[model samples]
Target: MPRTKGNHEARRRDVSEAVWRVLVAHGFGGLTMRAVAAELDATTGLLTHYFPAKRDLVAYALDLLERRSASRPRRAAGKGLSAVRAALLDILPLTDEATDSNRIWVSSWDAALANPELSDDYARKYAKSREKLRDLVAAAQQLGELPDGDPARIAAGAQSFVLGLVVQALFDPPAFPSHRQAELLDDYLATLNSPPSSGGDHEILS
Candidate 1:
């Protein structure tokens, strides 16, 4: 029997779904050709038809993760500090879906560190995320909602805080529930709104 274009497309979709399932269950560390094959109930030979090497498979999975992250619903648009808060909150693992995604993202760090190409890709992705936060921080400063300082520095700090929170939440779900996470984020943001001291040390915010 000859395979038609539709059949090939359907098979590709099945492969993608299988890859996602493997990622969610095992993270990148467990993302092997054998694991994906087991999830799909297919053979490694079939995966090889699509991805010739382990790196190829890993790269595809990473790209798939990025697409999923981008397509997920974002917080409603706003301005100033409110918008900054919304953007930061959107990154938290507040929902089950987000928790799973964050777990996969965290797991990818080891792989990214080992591979120079993947390391570069992750660096660019983080830079882009920081750039978005920086713009929002600059807007908030312009509106006088936040203290005067370097927007880029503030944004980097915010990103670091959120990522650290994410790891904590992932490790201790009982301790860092969604509401607690939100409250902590609010507390952090509130500090930014404080007026500068007589000492004029912007490092307080940084």
Candidate 2:
């Protein structure tokens, strides 16, 4: 039977999803084409028709993960610090789905270490993500929910904290449960949301 372009693309999408499942089940180390094929109950030959190399399959899986991360539903939480908090919470591994995504993301960091292209791409992505966090902090300050501070520094610190928290949540889920992570994040943000200082130069954290 002749394969149409539409069918081919559909098959590629299925293969990519299988890759995601493999990643979720076994992390990056288990994302081989054969493993994905096994997850799909298909053959390696079929996957090879879509992804010639393992790197291509891995890259496509990462791209799909990023798209899924961006498409998560986010609440407005009104304006001011609440808005910033809402945005930050949306990035955490709060849900089962989010936990899987975070696990894959953490595993991908190691994979990216050997793949310069993926590393550079993620570097840009992380920077953009941090910029959004920075903007949220600045917006909260402008709305008088937070004290005046270097928005860039605040955002950078927040980003660093979130990254570390995510790792802990992934590996030590018992200790850093979702609610605990939220409590810590909210508590830290609360410290920054003090009454605006007269000097207008208060640091984000003491």
Candidate 3:
């Protein structure tokens, strides 16, 4: 029997979630239809019903990671800067769940680089995320929670900094602990929240 579109999408979502579990447990290298089927306690034939090819499944899995990361709880973002901070911190590998998601992202990168569809999809997702960050920065600035400057530039810098810290924390948790990451983020935002220097200030060097 032919499945309805809604049912097909629901099944796809369920299969993609199983794929996500396999990706998180085994990374990209270990992902396969068999592994995903095993995760779902199903046969590869059922998975292939929705995703006929491995690339299709991989793309869906990577897309799932992006969606999951973006959908993190937002109950903490009640204010301007706090909202921005909460959004940015959600991307970091701070908790066990976040760490697993970051690992999946890292694992998917090499494959994304090789596949044009994946690459374009990743680029689009990142561009959208940066735009959201820029909007948050602009909001904070308007609310006097952040200093006035180029909000776009600030957003780009913040994104880069967070990505770098994610890598560092993933590589060496002992050296770059999660609390330290939070402290550094607070310090960075504090700098952004600082008042602009007066124009009449003079510097003398010897």
Candidate 4:
């Protein structure tokens, strides 16, 4: 029987996710329609039905990641600083799932070096991500949980830190354990408070 449009759409998502899994597990080279078909238990033609070209499929998967990741911070905003930290950390490739994403993402980043066309997508995602981090850092400062540095700069630095951790995880997954990261984060928080030993400079480094 022919599937309805809704069923087809659901199946399309299933195929897309399957492609994502293959891309992460293997590499961009592994994201052939055959792989997605194997994962979805569908025919190779089925993937072509949804994404006529391999490039289209790649773009769709990348956009899906961008949108899914973009929503993490906004939802965490209501929960405040702790929530922000949790949400922002989600971007780091710490866990298996994040590592999977990073596998594909770093590949995409490398691809961008040779393909200027893909670089546009990278820039767009980067801008949106930095803005989200900026908002989180600004919120932390407002709550007195962070020092009153330039929020944008702090955001950039925090993003840099997470990026470093992600790259480190690619080589050594246990390098930046979450507990230690949290300890360092807390240490930074400590600096935000007025040093009783020093004069009255609540903002730290005063």
Judging by lDDT against the true structure, name the best candidate.
1
How would the candidate models be sorted by TM-score, starting from the highest?
1, 2, 3, 4
For model 1, how many clashes?
Answer: 0
Q: Among all windows of ten consecutive residues in candidate 3, which has the lowest summed lDDT? A: 197-206
lDDT of 1 by residue, 166-204 (tens): 999999999999999999999999887877566646666
Write one digit per residue (lDDT tens) for candidate 4, span 1-206.
68799987877678767877887776776777788888888898877878899888777777776665655333334544675576556766656666777777776676666677778867877777788878877887788776667878766766776676667667675766666655655554454443435555566664
Count of clashing pairs, candidate 3 = 0
| Root-mean-square deviation of every model | 2.5, 3.6, 4.2, 4.8
What is the alpha-carbon lDDT for the whole of candidate 4? 0.69
Where does candidate 2 clash, by residue pair? none
Clashing pairs in 4: none
Order the numbered candidates by lDDT, best leading.
1, 3, 2, 4
Residue 1 of candidate 1: its Cα lDDT? 44
Model 4, total clashes: 0
Query: Candidate 1: where is the Cα deviation over 4 Å?
Result: 198-206
Best TM-score among the predictions, by candidate number: 1
In candidate 2 the C-alpha lDDT for residue 156 amounts to 85
lDDT tens string, model 2, 29-59? 8889889889889989978877899888877
* Residue-by-residue lDDT tens digits, candidate 3, 21-86: 898888998999999998888899988886899987876777788788778655477668998899
Q: In lDDT terms, how accurate is model 3?
A: 0.85
Deviating ranges (above 4 Å) for candidate 4: 71-84, 184-206
Full-model lDDT for every candidate:
0.92, 0.84, 0.85, 0.69
